[model samples]
Target chain A: MINLQPYENPMYFGYLLIGLLPIIIGMLYEKRFRWYETLFSFCFLVLIFDGPKLGQGIALIGYTIFEVLLTWGYVRYRTRPKGANKTSIFVLAVILSIAPLVVVKFTPLFDPQHPSIFGFLGISYLTFKVVGMIMETRDGMIKEFNILKFLQFLLFFPTISSGPIDRYRRFIKDYDRVPTKEKYLELLEKGVHYVMIGFLYKFILGYFFGTLLLPNIEKIALINGHSNVLGLSWSLVGVMYAYSMYLFFDFAGYSLFAVGISYIMGIQTPINFNKPFASWNIKEFWNRWHMTLSFWFRDYIYMRFVFFMIKHKVLKSRIAIANLGYVVLFLIMGIWHGETWYYIVYGLFHATVMILTDAWLRFKKKHPDLLPSNRFTKVMSVVLTFHVVCFSFLIFSGFLDKLWFGFR
Target chain B: MDNVRETVLEILSDLTGSDEIKANPDINLFETGLLDSMGTVQLLLELQAQLDVDAPVSEFDRTEWATPNKVVAKVESMQ
Candidate 1:
């Protein structure tokens, strides 16, 4: 009867913390109770998906079973070392693992009224994990698979909805051992701090930017829609900053909670944000912002593409290969977001910026004397990068879609 | 040995953008964030270009070739 969306409000945080009390105590005593962790994950998952959202809950269960069986089958075959793992077969398995998520994402494009039955909250994030595991297994990075461990990794409650997507090996290392009390105390200290920061970000500042101000700003931006050649206006600028702030605080706040809880459980899940706003260039920005997700993309998508291109002699130069990889990577990211013109444009925008950034960095490398390396220039770069990122977020906001369609 | 150390230092410095990078055999480049999988790719490419130590990317893991010294040894073994 107790159906709760995870971290939906301040009250949800209280409930979560209260529920985590036992785990906190267990970690303090230097004991990692795996069974207890599993039990809590299940209960909280139920709270999130039962009741009105029971359809999603059921979908999650079926989807998990499919993924686990698929991964198990792949790992068993891979472990044999002499198995004929054909590329086409492996590709089919990957597609099968992603089938549910792909349907969930694109179902509404053709028929908005009938969403896919397999759809559920966190499907995209979970698919990322499943697909990642399959690829890593194909590469022989994961030697053997255990069903329970695979399930636990996929359903790791805190990061299930959205992730600082943890790697399989990195996760196993943390889950398999209990930290010493001294180290756990350190973890606890950081955990508490992260949660406090999260409260400020999500509950306080996010409410101000998203709940209190965004709607009013949207009204103004709409009113001034046709005042410029590109339909840009001063009010539109406000929407950009407000929306970017809201996005950062809300998402980063969720990541902090996930990471904080993982720490309390002695799982040291990776951090997601690292002062993303302070980055000096687009490459550095990717390194800092939603770090786990970007790194996942880098490792699984971008890096693999580049490696494949080089190995097969698909491109002439290293630079060309990297550039092509960036385009394909960001375009896929945009598509993964949703099948919308704005999202696709947003992806192309980032790809262009990165390509330009690479060129500039190469040029700067050659002519270090031409571009002054003063604090002023550094500040200018940060400010410019910040605006560039904000403008991209504006495209991502789909305000243009609303504007062009004359939606009030 | 000296040539390998110099080659390692050159690759490490370029990737990290640190002019002061030292060729300390014990220093773990991965832990220091100077090298990751992408950097590993770069290092492998550089090694082939400079020293002709070629190996399949599938055959290597980051943890095995985590440090500069290990990387040097890996390249040497391949040769």
Candidate 2:
């Protein structure tokens, strides 16, 4: 039995390119082999989850079927003029869609000895897609739910593992149309370029930062930084920068591969990262980093909460409502990462910084003449924001937890 | 309608920190990054406070209120 994780190694790309050639050729001559594309997607899914990972394969299939039924049911109900379209029903559907992922997330935290039966590697990403489907249906954004299309979107092999989460309508637009000859050629060009960038980022630089430098830096930090007992040392700082680079390169590399492959398939899936390190503020950093997920959080969680707060007159101050929304959104996100103190702290740290940034912006608004915005100040702002973000990454690395808790 | 447009643009420009936003009446506020859902909340409040018109969030569809002009018309209709 042969199994391949998507973009796990260079050898995997060799197989991927071979498989993709037929699709590319078909696409060039104004033909899209839809059936073959589905088959191709399935074969890759099998290679990733079959064999020793059969358990996860079963879990993914069960999860997919469950999502199909739930979302399709909601869609059918929504289109009915007299059918029940209550908010409670929508909320119930949303909860059911995400219930599996919630169980998967909580399993290890409570019972370290055993994981959930419904757990799989990309369950979280799948849940995001399904939840989006349900929410959009309730909002009347999605007028129809084509089962086959939903399945294809849910199991889109390129982005199944981790996502730059694509919207159903946006994805359908690209999927349902074959690009013109000129446009296909452009996509081909960009696809190859994105893949090459992936190679540089994942194969070369990711290897250097994550596999090579990260462990060494971590060891030095643990040995020296731990001795301080107060958890402040240059070695600890070294771990922060190294881990941040490793995290950025590794994830960005994977996203490029996913997005590049989607482009080759003529689906213009969104790009995930946009030079996040250069952001001069936390809000801007979020827009440029793991963008799809953050934007998903922003649209679904943060904004929705603010609307709810204002609708009910729950909070009197607009600024207070915004800050409150940030706290709840990040807290939920923190819990989603894992049930760990470090993860929670990482979330809280960002929320606090964002609140500060908001307050500072408000202050700067009142004192426009007092605050300067020269090229030097712009450079300084970027530098300062980068370090503050790095400090948050340090909390996220869980190294401090290991240094403090694991040692003692 | 002109007064309504000026008020909407003023609130939007102040919220987004961009004076240039007021110039484009037909710009898709959400897509152009001039306005977001949070900005929508503020826009609704300002419309109510300044113009004595209620633009409820539930009624605020992106397509219906896609621009400053559309917003002005929507608010003016409530009068």
Candidate 3:
């Protein structure tokens, strides 16, 4: 028995490539070895959770069973001869599906030493998939439920840990059939390229920023600026940029691996990053950064909230409704990250900035002469957005908590 | 169908603050910065109100509804 967190090291990819070789060969011949793929996924799942993480392994199994039953029950109820899609049942299904994740998130607050038995790595990602299914089911989008396909989608080993969060419909499209020979070859090439980039981003750049530089900068900041209010220092600035780069490379790198592996298996998993730092506005930044997650929030949370407001006439002014939508969306995202003041503040901060950005955009629209849309302004906006994002990341890093309150 | 087209174009023009929506029926509203998530909501609401085409937000696939012509077609289909 061995435990290996996904994409944890370069060597892990060696093992991954070896396991995927068979699938790759099969795809080249325009065939899919479904049983072999299942076996490969099972073995990898064991390698990831069988050894020291047995508790989490057990938790994963139990969680999957519970979610499958819950989702299955919902689908049955919804499709049962002129379905009565009651809002109460839908809400209850969503809450029950997220209950384990809630417990896992809140466990530390109540008992610091023992994590919740319900806790496991990638619980949030799994919960996202489940909730998405439930919502789509409510909308009559997922009309039929098959246990095997649902299991495969939920436990797609490559992205089981963290995801570029593929949707049920999207995943099934690729899984149900093998790609054409040309398309499979193209996917294979892109998959290899993405994995190489992941190596560079995670092993080289992410290592430099996160493992080597971040700690030293943090130490200097603490030592130099502990006496100062809010512990501000030049080194703290360094920490901000370094941690932001590290965060991007590390998560983006992991996302690349997930997507690359998925592509190798003929599932065109959605990408998670797309030049996020180059974004010229907060809105654009979110659209590019950790894209799948943000898109999920946009589609599921923000859009839904806005529509709810409009439908219920919760507010008169559309601006106020949109602004409140940002608040709710960001606050939930912040709380999703953790139960910490810094995380909550990070969410609120984004919400505030989003509101302000909307105001600026509206004002610019009104007086186009005041804020000319030109190359210089575009570049400046990118620089400004970059720094704003880094500052938010600094808040997100929870280093400020350690600096001010002497705890992380 | 013509009425639906006119109504949709009117809404698109108002939401995007540009009359060019009627000129380029095949233009991608999203890529051209004409429609976004917010605009999509407004578009759906308008369609529901004016044309009685009730497409839910969850079913609004961006790709399928990207262009003005496609939007017009979709609205007509829903009718």
Fnat for the candidates in order: 0.13, 0.17, 0.52
Compared with the true structure, the alpha-carbon lDDT of candidate 2 equals 0.85
DockQ of each model vs. true complex = 0.28, 0.27, 0.73
Highest TM-score: which candidate? 3
What ranking emerges by lDDT with the best candidate at the front?
3, 2, 1
For TM-score, candidate 2 versus 3, the one ahead is: 3
Across A33-71, the per-residue lDDT of candidate 3 in tens digits comes to 989999999999998898799999999999999999999
For model 1, the DockQ equals 0.28
Backbone clashes in model 1, listed as residue pairs:
none
The second chain of candidate 1 has a TM-score of 0.78
Which ten-residue region of model 3 chain A has the weakest summed lDDT? A1-10
CA lDDT, candidate 2, residue A165: 92
TM-score of chain A of each: 0.97, 0.98, 0.98
Query: lDDT tens string, model 2, B5-70?
Result: 777778877877876677667777765556755788777777777888865444565678887778
lDDT of 1 at A171: 88
Q: Evaluated on chain B only, what are the TM-scores of all the candidate structures, in order?
A: 0.78, 0.85, 0.95
Q: Candidate 2's residue-wise lDDT over A1-408, tens digit each? A: 987788987668998998899999999998999999999998899999999889999999999899899988889989997866898888889999899899899999889898898898789888887887777777677888798899889899899999979988889999999899899999999999998899889888888988999899888777776556676778778888988998899899999999999999999989999999999888889889998899788867887788778878998998889998889988988888999999999889999998998788778867889868899998999999999999899889888888888756
- Docking level for model 1: acceptable
Model 3 spans > 4 angstroms off: none
